[model samples]
Target: MEIILVPAFADNYLYVLRDPASGKVAAVDPGDAAPLMAELERRGWGLDLILLTHHHNDHTGGVAALVERYAPLVVGAGHDSHRLPPLGRAVADGDRVAFGGTSAEVIATPGHTLGHIAYWFAQDEALFCADTLFALGCGRLFEGTPGQMWESLLRLRALPDATRVCCAHEYTLSNARFAVTVDPDNAALRARAEEIAARRARHEPTVPTLLGVEKATNPFLRADDPGVAAAVGLVGSSPDRVFAELRARKDRF
Candidate 1:
């Protein structure tokens, strides 16, 4: 399995998952269709599926166009049908989607949006986590509460440490800065911050971050850590409260 990142409209990203042996491809959150179409044409690959993680325009805007062009099978969360592009298969948690000889398990992640879901390809150790988890940060609480997002993060964190997290936007540098503000004492975070700065300086993308690295450096995921709790003046607080406080600070940051 090969994953190709397609940058679109400002910081958003659309991913193409390809099966090298079969030349079949699947698109994940294609916010724009032109780039994806161009790439597919360039590679001489046929689109077999379109996987949607949420109903947000930036994530599903290109669905209609792609469908018109390729007539691919579309899959999305059932509860979000009103907002999402027409789905051939409406899925919920525990549902599996197979394409190009690879399969992904749907994970209900409802913080960014109530019906948001993530696609976890266990065999590839890759997660198409739309806007739920970012590098050193998590998505804004638009529709769900901080507790729901926290639970979702915990579920994702439980995956293998080496799992590659493919987030939908390029928010790593700003997120790293905010993380340092709250986790100033973490040497690991400081080092990661520097690395992020250097990568941005070179105009590089800091995505597909390893889950282990996020566990160590992402403040949102470290709500239970002593340093993070103390920094947010929530010592002895539950992880949910700590997470809420951190998210609130980030909203204002």
Candidate 2:
């Protein structure tokens, strides 16, 4: 499976997962059709499916347009069917769907939204985590509880070390800034922030970082570290409290 990242609205990303051998491609979160359609036309790839992780406008806004043009099958979280654009398959956790030759495992990751889900393909070492997990930070809990978000994050963090994290937005630079503040003595975070800044200066992307690397630098995934525990006042707090405090600190940051 070849993963193609397409930048969409502001900082959002639209992913195209393709089976080059079979000449079939599936788009994940086509927020708008203009840019994605052009990209498809340029590559001469046929879009066969739409994999939506949530109901947010920036993630599902162009679903109707794309479906109208390509008539691809739309897949969305079963719990968010009411909100998601006309969907063909409503999946839940543990459900598996096939793309030309690749398979995507639906992971129920609710935090950014109650019904938010992520697509994982171990064979390709990639994940289409729409707004749930980022480079150095995690998404804000819009509707779910802190405990729910924490557990959800833990689930993703438990994935294999080689998993390539392809998040939904260009938040690496901003997240690195906040992460350094959250853990000032983290030398790795310091170095990465500068590198991410340079990438932004060159107008380059800073994504597809390995999950193992995020474990070393991302504050949201370091809730057990002494620095992160202290920063979030989690020394004697429950996971829910820690998550809430950590989120609050990021909000202020």
Candidate 3:
């Protein structure tokens, strides 16, 4: 499987997943059709499927246009049918959908949106997690509570350490800054912050981050850690409470 990152409006990222063996391709959250269509034409690839993680405009804005152009099978959360574009296959948690020679396990990750979902291609060791997860942070709880978001994050935390996280935006640099402010004593986070600065300076992407790296450095995923809990003034609190405090502080930051 080959993954192509297509930058969309501002920091949004649209992805193209291609199966080299079958030459079949799928678009994941196309924010715009022009760039994606151009990329497909450049690579001489035909779109076969459209996978949506959530109903956010930045994620699904180009769906109608692409559907008209490629006539690909659209797949999205059945629970969010009213909000999503027409879905050929409306899936829920644990549903496995085949693409080319492999299949992706659908994980219902509801936090960014009530019907948000992620695609885990185990064979490819890739997690196409839209706004639910980010490079150095997690998504804002716009439609869900802090508890729901925290639980959703815990689910993602259980994935293999080496799994590559394909998040949907370029928010790493700012997230890193916020992370260092909250976890100032964390050497790993400090190192990562510096690296993020350098990468952004070069106009390079810091995505597709290793889950292990996030586990060690991301404060949002480390709410259970004593250091992180104390840093956020939730020393004796439960992981959920710590996470809530962290999220609140991030909202103000």
Compared with the true structure, the alpha-carbon lDDT of candidate 1 equals 0.93
Q: What digit string (tens of lDDT, one per residue) describes model 2 on residues 133-224?
A: 99888998889887888888999999998999999899899898888877888888899899999999999999878899898999888776
Model 3 TM-score on a 0 to 1 scale: 0.99
| Candidates ranked by lDDT | 1, 3, 2
By TM-score rank, best first, the candidates go 3, 1, 2
Number of clashes recorded per candidate: 0, 0, 0
* Per-candidate TM-score against the hidden true structure: 0.98, 0.97, 0.99
- What does candidate 3's lDDT look like per residue over 53-86, in tens digits? 9999888999999999889999999999999999
Which run of 10 residues does model 3 get worst, by summed lDDT? 244-253
lDDT for 128 (candidate 1)? 95
After superposition on all CA atoms, what RMSD does each candidate show versus the true structure?
0.8, 1.1, 0.7
Any runs in candidate 1 off by more than 4 Å, and if so which? none
